[model samples]
Target: MNFEKIVQERYATKTFDGKSIPQSEVEKLLEIIRYASSSFNIQPWIIKIIPDKETKDKLSPASFDQPQIKSCSHLLVFCANKNVSENIDKLEKLMIANGSDPEKAREYTNMMRDFEKGMTDEKKLAWAQRQTYIALGNAINGAKSLGFDSCPMEGFDSDAYAKILNLSSNIVPTVLCPIGYGTDKPKPKLRFPKEEVFM
Candidate 1:
């Protein structure tokens, strides 16, 4: 489908059919998310894809008992990585391995490090959380492009999710995206006028 159609038809799915999306399609959606743009190319996010009913059941209460949590085929927990400098280090190594000049890579890494140094711990987490939203945007839109439905959600307990998922302290659960075939239909497209929004 074209980009316009994807955007027009995509909605926050309320319920799903409980049928699994093809693994290949899910992988493609992951790749699309991986390619999403991020500030300084830090890519400060890790996604945990849960595809089993047992785990979904465990997560439902944490998600306010949202129907989408248990009904969806795959529940994606987008975690923001708080270790920004570590990712910058890894990116620098990748740059050099991919034929970038050593001097240029060092310069890039140093710049990222300098920028990271200016942030407090709170700022760091906030920045990482913001970057995760970019990936979340790709995820929901990408799911539609790949012939599935998705719901972008922030109605879950992050601390509970982290404990249930066994995530490290540095990985913060920022948002959720539940994907599958929608059982419910869209109501209508409601939006502000183009002029109002554009201005």
Candidate 2:
């Protein structure tokens, strides 16, 4: 399907049929999410995929007992990785390994490091969380492109998620996305006109 159709047809799925998406398809969708844009290519996000019913059951209450949590085939927990300096170092190494000139890679990574130094911990987390949303955008759109359904949800307890998932302090849960075959139909699109949205 074309991009326009995918965007127009895709909706925040309210409920999903209890069906498992194929592992191969899930991986493909993940690749699409991985390619999401980030500032300076820092890519400060980690996604945790939950496939089992037991864990989803546990997470449902934390998600305000949302039906999507338990009904969807898989739940993707997007987290912001706050270890900005470490990621900058890793990116530099990756660049050199992929045939980038070592000197140029170091120069680029040094620039990123300098940028990272200016941000406080709070700012780093906020910035990383913003980047995580870009990936989440890809996930919802990619699900539709792959003929599945998805919901981007933030109506949850982040602290509870961090505790239940046993995530590290640096990996802050930013958002939730549940993907599967939608049992519910899409409602009409309620969006502002282009003229109203644009300045």
Indicate which candidate wins on TM-score: 2
* RMSD to true structure for each model, in Å: 0.8, 0.6
What lDDT score belongs to each candidate, Candidate 1 first? 0.96, 0.97
Model 1 TM-score relative to the real fold: 0.98
Compose the digit string of candidate 2's lDDT tens values, residues 78-130: 99999999999999999999999999999999999999999999999999999
Model 1 residue 193 CA deviation in Å: 1.4
Off by over 4 Å in 1: none
Q: List the residue pairs that clash in candidate 2.
A: none
Q: Estimate each model's TM-score.
A: 0.98, 0.99
| Model 2 vs. true fold: TM | 0.99
lDDT of 2: 0.97
Cα deviation at 44, candidate 1, in Å, is 0.2
